[model samples]
Every structure is written in C-alpha cells, then in structure tokens.
Target: MTVQLPPLPEIHHPKIQALFQKSDRELVTLFQRHPEEGQYFAAIFCRYGQVLYTLISTATRSPVQSDYLFVKTWEYIYHEMRVLDLRVTTPRLSLQSWLINIAAMMINRAEVPPVEEIQYSLKDTPPVFWCYLNQALNQMAGNLRLVLLLSQTFQWSHTRIAAYLHAEGESISASDVKQLLVRAYQALEDALPEDIRDIYLAQPAVTA
Candidate 1:
C-alpha cells in the first residue's frame, strides 16, 4: 500500500492578484523589484500571450513553427528581464511593442516556408477592383510596400517594423513606419474607385 501525499498549498494572494490589474509598465516594475514573486510575470504572460501568438502564427504560417516561436519569444523575454535592466532597455516602451520586437527577431531568424499564392479568378471579385488594387500596390515605394506588408500582412507593431528594418540596415524609426503606413493607405484610397474604396475601408483592420 502507498501512503497518501499532502495537498499542495494555493498560490493565490491579494498582493499577487492586484498585479493582474496593473498596467504593463507597472507590472514590469513590480516584477523587477520582486524577481522571485513569479506572479508579475504570470500577469504579463496572460496579458500578451494571445497577441504574441497571433504575430508568431502570421509570421511562421505553420502551426508547429508558430508554437515553437511562441515559446521561444517568451523565453527570450524572460532571459532579457533577468539579465538586463528593464527600465533602461524598455524605457516608455509599450509592453506589446516590446514583445513584438522580440517575436519579430525570432521570426526573422527562422526559415519559414513561402506561402503559396492563391490565384483568384476574375469572376470571383470585380476585375476592375483587382486592377485598381494592383495599381495601388504597385504605386507604393518598395520600402513603403515592405512596411505595409510588415504592419498589415504580418500584424507587426510600428516599433517591431522599425527595429526589423533597422536590423536589415535600413535607417527607419517607429515614427517613420507610422508615416509610411499612412502614405500607403492614402495611396490605396486614391487609386481605388469610390465604391471599391468604401469596400476596402469597411474591411476589418489587421492586428497582432
């Protein structure tokens, strides 16, 4: 016969529960102050886990790769938090943006397979609309196109887009990324007809 084991104690506490209500910055600060608490990090994970998962899924486009990147991104964040000063490294940085930056780096390093292009028949949608859309995309500058793809297609944050561009030896700032996105959208709106533009505008915004 085996002896019975004692039940584990509950980990809940009023102070720890309060961390869930704190802002990202506030939670990070508390975590920095009390590295051993673990609750602060748990709070952060609960807040941003889905956002980062979406970003990773979009970037990898493979369930297995997305799962790996999701875990790796958080591992990188935890390592950085333990080794660096969060106040110095992420001063005034939105937690979502910071997490996206880490995810973007991991995605860049991974070798993701190319997505197969879906060939749509002209009858599927208005051929005129497709033509106008192509023209609009073509009119965008190469850098602007890249920024749009990163922001709209991959659901990257402006900060992540800027950082990725900078890593690729392009001198870009987050403000520049925002401006580029605005210019791209304006160009698309200008190229499309009024009806098509309205249709496009009614589409849901992409988020990461």
Candidate 2:
C-alpha cells in the first residue's frame, strides 16, 4: 500500500507569506527587475535544501551525484520560474510536487559512469562496503532511504524525523515514525548482499 505524505505547511513568517501570496506575474517581475531577490530566496533554500538533498541522495546513491543534482535542480527551478506561464489549472500539481517529479525524471535519466570511474582507492583499505551501500540505497526510493539514514545511521528521534517529513509545524505521532523507520531498515537489510547483510546485522548500534 502507498503511504500518504503529510500536508505541507503554510509560511508563517509575514514576509515569506507575502512573497508566496503574490501572483506568479509579480514574482516573475520581481525576479527579473530586482535580481537581488536572491537574499530572500535563501529562505526557501534553507527550508527545503536538506530535504531535497536527502531525496536526491537516495535516488542517485552517490554523494557526489546527489550534490550535483541538488544544485542543478535549483538552477533549473530558477530558470523555469522566470519563464513559467503561471497559468496552469492543475489542482493536484503544486510547485513542490512539480519540482519533485522533474527531479525524479532527471535522476532516472542520469547516466551512471563505468565501474572504473566509480572505483575508490584508499591506502591499505578497500572501499567495497561503500560501493555495496550505494548500490543497495539506489534500490530504494528517496523517502524510505531518508527514513533509514535518519533512523539508523543518524539515530534521530522519531519525533524529529516525523517533523522533517511532515513539514507541518506539529509533530507526527512517534508510533508512525517508528513504523516507517522499521520498514526502511528492513528494506535496506533485505537489499544488502548476504555477506554484508550479516555483518551489518551483527554490528552494534551506531552511536548517535
């Protein structure tokens, strides 16, 4: 069954609320004439950058690619917003969802380099584990992987993870976040190679 994402929050800050409330035409005009609006634009990036990185990292399974894609996505958005007709009538596709879909498409179409390019050489130690982890992470989607990394690697509290995912000012129930974390961990466990899986399973809890 598909999981339901929580509703997005409204901008509470008066300045931000005012910016968002402005017509698309107004925003485009400001962008073209003001140019220095980049200062205020940071507010949007500050709020969504981590979430976007989390999503792209899970999809690309490469930190380098994730970094690249995240930047590219924003650049694309900046360009598109400047030229967007802003007259669309689709009720279901908000700006966030539209950008997400574009990101997904860009990620899927991205070309993976040859194995040689991916090889990591270090002094005396093999990077095999990282390679395996990347492969396994790519098998899962962004949301699940975010849950896994936050819950397993970072050991963030369920309430915190829920707060990030929900985007709502209110925290989600701890039980709900716990369930999502469990499922993400299970998926990662199943995707891992047998040898690596055993090692990961045998390891003690990761320190916060």
Best by lDDT: 1
Alpha-carbon runs more than 4 Å astray in model 2: 1-29, 89-92, 112-208
How far is 6's C-alpha from truth in model 1 (Å)? Answer: 30
Write candidate 1's Cα lDDT for 137-190 as tens digits. Answer: 777778877888788668899999999999999998999899999988887667
Stretches of candidate 1 off by over 4 Å are 1-17, 83-92, 111-208
Candidate lDDT (C-alpha), each: 0.62, 0.55
Candidate 2 weakest lDDT stretch, 10 residues: 1-10
Reference-based TM-score, model 2? 0.38
RMSD of each: 22.5, 20.3
Give TM per candidate: 0.42, 0.38
> Per-residue lDDT tens digits of candidate 2, residues 1-208?
2222122222233444556555434555565565433323433443454566567777766555554555556656655655554457365565556667667876777665543354332211112234345557879877789878887667699888887877855456778878877787788767766544433334555898
Error of 2 at 108 (Å): 1.7
